[model samples]
Target: MQEVSATASLWKVALSLLVIIAFIPASLWLLKRFQLAQMKLGKTDIKILSVQSLGTKEKLMLVEVENEKVLLGVTSHTITHLKSFPKRGRPFDSELVQAQHEQVRQSQGDDK
Candidate 1:
């Protein structure tokens, strides 16, 4: 196998550092732009504490927007995909939690 010289290795590292430095400012600018755009779109200051099902068909979301509690009807096909951010918080569901715990215990027993 061929060996790399110290000067060449140093040059490669310098180039990589330069590339990262150049992208840093551009990435920051883009992120700021995105946030500014989102702000301009007029978003709500809602803190969704809990959500529950209204009935067998309709779904409801308990949202606290600007110190005011509102019952928002979740107008979506799938109730499980009601997440805006990555892992915001788990919704309350006693039956689902119990079922999941039972499944986990069963799986562990089977593995052993």
Candidate 2:
């Protein structure tokens, strides 16, 4: 009958929709699992060393490209090069720690 045909069509639509919904997540999972989200453009030399948030939309990033390390100021709308360092120097984290310790020592000396 026509009623049976209508019910069958509805079921077919529901099944198709469910399949499409499942396909989206499955494709995403496959992409992530295989690490295919980033397109390969030969060998990449740039590496992100560290990121520090300055505010809700601003950050400081230390990045290494080739043999030089760069300090960058990043915002939602812009990226600025703050400084660059030679690869022969101490690492970024160690220098940051050393600067912090120097600040603490200076503060303690002032408190005397």
**TM-score leader:** 2
Candidate 1, position 76, lDDT: 51
Record all residue pairs in model 1 with backbone atoms less than 3 Å apart, i.e. clashing.
none
Best by lDDT: 2
Per-candidate clashes, comma-separated: 0, 0
Stretches of candidate 1 exceeding 4 Å from the true structure? 1-4, 43-112
Cα error of candidate 2 at position 109, Å: 21
Error of 1 at 8 (Å): 1.4
- Model 2: per-residue lDDT, tens digit, 1-112? 9999999999999999999999999999998866744635446898788999999999999999997889999999999999998775777799899999999999999999
lDDT of each: 0.73, 0.91
lDDT of 1 at 30: 99
* lDDT tens per residue, model 1, 1-112: 1356877888999999999999999999999999989876867686677867777777778767555556556655654434333332445587589889999999999999
